[model samples]
Target: MAGANYTLEFGLEAATDDATIIARTVQEVDAALERVIAAASTFNHNPTAFVVERPRFGPLQFPDHGLKIDVDPRLGVAALAWVGPDFDCPWVTKSDRPVPGASLHKDIDSATPFPDDAAITLDQLRAAVHEFRESGGHRPKCVEWQEADGW
Candidate 1:
């Protein structure tokens, strides 16, 4: 499942409170925190190989105690928002899977299974941010319509 790429450029601090629900709810959260140890990782703010195609992932490449993947759960290739001059419309689109080219995770150079090099653009980044703000995380949730699904 290949799709668009997104870099948060920051990290969300551990949500610590006496709220037992949030604390003990998701086991992977703790694992995510531990793996994200150290500031250089941007507090795991930089999760390499985050496959955008699915909303939830598991046993991420860099596994430890526990793990899970929570993508936006939206279907659609990460596209350029086309908001500014920096934007470039893609040749391969959300409707088409990218022909193998650069490795998505090529930049990380670490222990991870996700290929990091996704064909994405600045406008898409901007759009994701704006949408994330408007909604809670960018894009609408849907089981992407695969060609096999009659797309």
Candidate 2:
């Protein structure tokens, strides 16, 4: 996990707590995920999916250079997505939409909304996070991707 560079942004408690938590290593990211799940379980309204991002290396902005993880701890599932140049998850059949499909974090940039199609398991979410960390923040190829609208 040496030299790992990534940012984990949370949107659960904007009015009462810090909105952003930066995780610079794999362990920190794992910890952040754990914290997020715990927070969701205790809160009533599900939070907008949190994001993992790296500093822009080129012209990437907004939906680019980031992987969004919307975890539903109560359901033990999550949605993973990203958007950028040629950067959308490929379609793999449609499924029920996850809660908070399009997450908006107050005071922070809104995460790219996920479509109604895929909801990955917790284990899968962990793997995807690892892949995102390993890839230095590029959208992970570990899971199938569907291109977002206007992509």
Candidate 3:
């Protein structure tokens, strides 16, 4: 079956811990998935027929499979992406809310290919989040591809 890419972005305060951040991120994802199911219901599609891969916290695992969720607490940003079966649903799109202190890189382009080895460890993720926040959410100037390419 053909697959489609999806991403969900949200903001969180820097003072939040890893557990809280991950919990909140998962909750947002769950709500979005529910919306997708609801929307699909109107079209006679069985939303449950599509297998869902949930996100895991603490460390990145099985980088080659399922749904992946990443967060940058410093930027108060969280992102969720799916790499499996296409949902063929219209509700899966960019977030409508304006995330405060979020860089344009917050969302992953659905067309861009994600590498298998790109997984970052929990420590690395936390460090990057800390660094990004410490830097005041300033994104480096991109001289090559467009700004969205950096995300």
Candidate that would win on lDDT:
2
List residue ranges in candidate 2 displaced over 4 A. 1-17, 41-63, 85-116
- Candidate 3: TM-score? 0.25
> Model 1: per-residue lDDT, tens digit, 1-151?
1132322212333223111111211233343333332222222222322212224437663211111111221222232111111223211113233424422221133523222223333234333333322232233222111111100
The Cα error of candidate 1 at residue 29, in Å, is 24
Ranking by lDDT: 2, 3, 1
Q: What lDDT is obtained when candidate 2 is compared to the true structure? A: 0.52
- Candidate with more favorable, higher lDDT: 2 or 3: 2
Worst 10 residues of 1 by lDDT: 142-151
- In candidate 2, residue 30 scores what lDDT? 78
Off by over 4 Å in 3: 1-113, 139-151
lDDT of 2 by residue, 1-151 (tens): 4235645554454233334566666787677677666664343333333235433445654434545445556667666555434544432212355444433221123334345455766777777766666665556677766655522
**Models ranked on TM-score:** 2, 1, 3
- Cα lDDT computed for each candidate against the true fold: 0.25, 0.52, 0.28
Error of 3 at 149 (Å): 4.2
Candidate 2 displacement at residue 143 in angstroms: 1.2
lDDT of 1: 0.25
Instruction: Give candidate 1 misplaced runs (Cα > 4 Å).
Output: 1-9, 12-99, 106-118, 138-151
TM-score of each: 0.27, 0.59, 0.25
